[model samples]
Target: MKSNLFISALFALTISLASCNSSNAKPQKKVETEKPDSAATTKIQVALLLDTSNSMDGLIDQAKSRLWNIVNTLTTLKYDGKTPDIEISLYEYGNDGLSEKSNYIRQVTALSQDLDLISEKLFALRTNGGSEYCGAVIQDATKELKWSSENNSMKLIYIAENEGFNQGKINYKEAISDALKNDIYVNTIFCGNKTEGINIFWKDGADRGKGKYFNIDSDRAVQYIATPYDDEIAKCDEKINKTYINYGSKGLEKKRNQAVQDQNAKRVSASNYTDRAVSKSKAVYKNESWDLVDKVKNDANAIAKIQKEELPAELKDKSTAEIQAIVTEKKKERETIQKEISVLAKKRQQYIDTEAKKTKTQDDLGNTINSSIMAFAKVKGYTVEK
Candidate 1:
């Protein structure tokens, strides 16, 4: 009886211990659920390296009028109406060699927050010649703008010049390679009218640059990049966070960007003009000068008629006599007003070149930095995309 009683007590105590152990055991962890963050997904930077040259007037107009569309597209990206962070830049080509101020360049930089300055520069652009596409691309993708490796920002470039883009000193392949090294993507926007070979070359550039290549034959790139009609009021105007519309004219200050080095930016020769006088000065071309040339011809003819006529030798050509008489009168005038005018013309050209240098360089830098800012704004939580 005592043994049976002791066994019963032992069994009860063992069962109680097992029950306590089971109750005290910790439960398994449940898998954590998380909300999808667009910002966390991927950061993006897009540079619109457009051709702001002679044949791109229509293209320029489109970009100017519809910048908002691209902005609107970017606005659509948001977790709860808060946009993603983005950076957008703009560039132009086909204005080099002929004039210092007029050259290919990346105007806007890697940001999109300021649509106003982008609009101003886009509108300010006019057509010229010389397409240095590769040079500008390399400058923007690697040199000037601040790109972060930590954010995984998608650096993209769009080349939109009508001409074949081999003019810039850098090779197309090398430009794309530089871009790729920085993890930036470059997309080529070519018109359908471009040569097959040229188009193929761009395709190669874009592929190597690790970006999409688009061929739009029409002058509708701006419209194509637009958002639907319903989404107009997008980015907020926060000073700390940066919003569109207020990006104001900040893009005008990026003159020293590396991509700008290859551009024929106009420079003011600080040298003072020659205070000394001379009998003969070089003739420069101008519209008013052309008018002067015409007027001078008339004055010369009047002077010839007023002068005593000398009989020409029978063997001498009649045309020769007329030319000689004209030359003599021009020589006489060279010592007076004409000489002074010539000097003034040189001075005028010097001043003009200086201003041109400032304007063109400012314009180029303006476009590059502004475009870069826009690209940045798009990537940095704005729901806008272009």
Candidate 2:
């Protein structure tokens, strides 16, 4: 009976050991699988908070004109020799059209990769008479948006306003401090005189946030320098547009909106239009939500997964293999067009740069934001490609 008891106890201990090993093994496997691939996971998040009160129409116009220019500038930055995904969020504060209960602020768009949607929202924004609340908007953006927690990711918030920095119930200092905790730097752009901006605590806000402070002439119009390559780039833009195959429920609508945005950019200036075209040639201007070519590029099985009803009329009757063939062809066509545009774009930029040397650099929304982006990116170990 003692020998029987000893064998039973030994069996129980063996089972316990097996159970513990099984449990430990799972967690170890989970950790291995869950480890993030930091090399491919870097991102750049930028939030633009613009005061859209009655006096800030020029600021709005500047934003509209320079949106593509800013995007093109951002495309030049790379982290660890790889280009990071760019996500932009927009906010409009001090607009009386917005709810006063929400401190006259509206989160226009959450941090998103949809460049077209951002352009559409920006174009829709209109100024109205309202009280400006810098601190409230900053605090709201910090808490509400889904900021990346990665230490290597570059996150920035640029708030442009002519009003006093210390406004509304929320304290700017505390708001900026909270932002800093999330690794977000809050830059301030004062749309008036430099001394006036400093006197009104704009500089202090930048200091507290550890970001750059700039005073821009928001009322001044953005000057465009036309180049000989603009016409060729425009032609390439038209050719690239043809390569997009619309799919999904919103595909057709989004395609129409893309054309509308093109018109909007053209209305700004020939140079602005060219800037938008150049941006479209870059990898950052992906429209996977609506474009089948882009969708298939991102997901190898996307063509097989797509429903026949969701495809465009021309593609709806095609078999899966046929559709795939078409997407492949379009992809190849797009790449070729994009390459042509890129070549022309280099020449266009060179001409513009040469012309720009004749004049003093204007401290406008685009220049200030672009310069600050370079400065901040360098500090974060990002390299700029020429």
Candidate 3:
């Protein structure tokens, strides 16, 4: 009987040990990680606030003609093996056409990737006599636009005006303070002589914001040294237009606007058209919402979401397989054209640089903005390929 009791106690101790070991063991868990957005990793937000009073017609013209130059400069920037999305917002201040109650300022466009629409607005700007309100416009732009919060994003405001920086009810100091609070670098381009600009407090405005100050000859005409590659680049741009399969209600209209912008750029000069084409070939010229090829490439389920009736007239009755085939073909063609354009643009730029060395060209708004962009871009870990 004592031996039987000893065996029973030993059995109880073994069971307790086993139970404690089991309780201490951890259960297997399912770990999950979030996927990165393949589209864009970084962004460059630029706000171009221009004075458009009657005396500043030259400034307006420079803004309109040299927009593509500014865009092309941004196109060369890259960080972490991905090109940044470029969002540009335009503001025209001191135009009498604008309401006095609104301080003669208008937010022409929000920060967006719609390059064509931006070109359209720039072309449409008309000068009028009005009071120049530097503070009001900057404050409005700072408060209104949806600026990126990413520390990597290069956020900047280039306010070009030829008037006293302190010529408004809203103090320039307060505007600069607000801009700095939002992590926006406010660069001032005084559209006159350097001494005159400093006397008018333009340099002070830039100093307060810790941004660059330029006294540019805004009235100077943009010089384009036409290269042998310009014609080929222009042809490639036209070929790209054919690849766009317009879808949705806005597709046709948007596609038409693209053509219109091309024409407008051409009207400026052949080199201007080439610049626009080069910009279009880059990743920043996205029209996914309207272009069927871009839409399908980005989202596999995009076609499934779209109603049959919403498709372009040419693609309305096509079967799903047939539609996919069409998109694939267009995508291939566009890629080829873009590659050709890229090659030609490099050659064109080389030619332009060689000529710039031989000429005594006055500094216009384009080169001025390009200088600032390149300087800032380097600081933000962006490398310009050319």
TM-score of 2: 0.93
The lDDT values for all models are: 0.45, 0.93, 0.89
TM-scores, all models, native as reference: 0.45, 0.93, 0.91
Please give, for residues 1-386, the per-residue lDDT of candidate 1 as tens digits: 99999999999999999999999989779888875564554445556776756666666655553343344333334523444455567666666533444344645545553333454455556767665556555655567766657443456666665556566566777767777778776666565554563555766666676654545443543212111211211111011011101101222132122112112111111111111011012221111111222234446443233223322232134464564454455445543544444445344435544665554332122233335445444554444321
Tens digit of per-residue lDDT, candidate 3, span 178-198 = 999998989999998999999
Model 1 per-residue lDDT at 292: 22
Error of 3 at 348 (Å): 1.1
Instruction: Tell me how far the alpha carbon of residue 8 in candidate 2 is from the true structure, in angstroms, after superposition.
Output: 11
Best by TM-score: 2
What digit string (tens of lDDT, one per residue) describes model 2 on residues 99-136? 98999999999999999999999999999989998999
The TM-score that candidate 1 achieves is: 0.45
Q: Which residue ranges in model 3 land beyond 4 Å of their true spot?
A: 1-39
